[model samples]
Target: MKAQMFDMTRMWGMVTGLVLAIAYFASLYLGFKASEMLPMLVTAIGGFEMFLFSQDVWIKRKRKHG
Candidate 1:
């Protein structure tokens, strides 16, 4: 039997994506516009997730090559 590592970064990314999707649909359903700041907030969160994923990849590569 093999054990798999739990990836918090991936989990967070999925959660963020799900929340954004739900918010978008809910706003549409209720006939209300999303706030102007929503896009900026999403961008910031996505950027942070990308940074975390890149860092994880870099660390794994470093360990593999060293």
Candidate 2:
């Protein structure tokens, strides 16, 4: 299958979200809790975005083959 612009955009977004989530986790581990709720919010958004992008890829591949 050919690579599309939308796929690239999604991949970048997923990577960025993952990175942000990791950074937030590290900060929390180091006791950098400037705001308790913000870290949870960021983690939730990042995890959701990752899940959505992964589901999109799986569905596209399944559709193409089946």
Candidate 3:
């Protein structure tokens, strides 16, 4: 069996996306009403990109494994 090769760029992007999402949700739940919504919107777009990239990665991984 071959070990999976991980790409650092994708990993970093994913990590950053997750952090952004966590912070956004945290601020929202913390009653930060004065918080600007622009950052949240940006984070959501970033999250969507990250999700699509990861899904593609998953499909590639499955193909490799099978």
Best by lDDT: 1
Q: After superposition, how far is residue 52 of candidate 2 from its true place, in Å?
A: 4.1
- What are the lDDT figures for the candidates, one per model? 0.77, 0.75, 0.70
lDDT of 2 by residue, 9-51 (tens): 6677777767777777788789886466656766776777778
Clashing pairs in 1: none
What TM-score does model 3 achieve against the real structure? Answer: 0.48
Considering every candidate listed, which one attains the maximal TM-score? 1
lDDT of 1: 0.77
As a whole number from 0 to 100, the lDDT of residue 21 in candidate 2 is 73
Candidate 3 C-alpha lDDT tens digits along 1-66: 122234555566667777766777787889775357648665776876768789999999999999
TM-score of each candidate?
Answer: 0.63, 0.52, 0.48
RMSD each, Å: 4.7, 4.0, 5.7
- lDDT of candidate 1 at residue 11, scale 0 to 100: 78
What overall lDDT, based on C-alpha atoms, would model 3 receive against the true structure?
A: 0.70
lDDT by residue (tens digit), candidate 1, 1-66: 122234765676768866886787788789999987766766777777788779989999999999
TM-score of decoy 2: 0.52
Question: What ordering of candidates by TM-score runs from best to worst?
Answer: 1, 2, 3
